[model samples]
Target: MAIYELRTYNVIVGKMSEVVSHYKNEGWPALAKHPQKLVGYFTGDVGAINELIHVWKFDDDADRRAFWAGVYGDAEFMAFAAKIRPLIAQQQNKLMLSAPWGPQP
Candidate 1:
């Protein structure tokens, strides 16, 4: 079964657009080279402001670790991360497993 990761980025006030733009233009494309699967990307519409949420799926913990290790060492992704670091106020992630009876993606 695939393991899912829910990643949320809390951006500095009024800097959400910049972060989204950078991800749309550079980050996502670069990450696509890896084996992980992107489920979706979303921005806050209500509740919290300046927040971005994205989901990814991997075969397992080892797959997730290997993919991220590559991303961390990738010069292009590293540069992209540097550019967006100042825009992010906080970040959070959770790993999830699907229930057997639940809807599958």
Candidate 2:
């Protein structure tokens, strides 16, 4: 069974566009170099404003940690993070397990 991670980024006011553009243009590509699996990416439509949400899956906690290690070590990813980090005000992450009776991806 895979573990799912829901990550949310709350951006500073008026900086959502820069964050989204950087992720779309550079972050996603950099992440793809690793073995991590991205389920989806979305922008908040209601409630929380200037928020971005993305879901990822991993075989286990070790797999998740390894994936992050690779990401952090990648020069491209490091540069991308340097650019986007200032745009984000806060971040939230939740680990989830799929219900046995639910449909699996």
lDDT of each: 0.89, 0.91
Q: Please write out the lDDT profile of model 1 over residues 4-57, one tens digit for every residue.
A: 999999999989889989998989888877765789889988897788998988
Report the lDDT tens digits of candidate 2 across residue range 1-105. 789999999999999988989988999899888884789889998897788999998999998888888889999999999999999899999999998896886
Query: Least accurate stretch of 10 residues (summed lDDT) in model 1?
Result: 28-37
Q: Report clash pairs, candidate 1.
A: none
lDDT of 2: 0.91
RMSD of each: 1.2, 1.2
**Over 4 Å off in model 1, which ranges?**
none
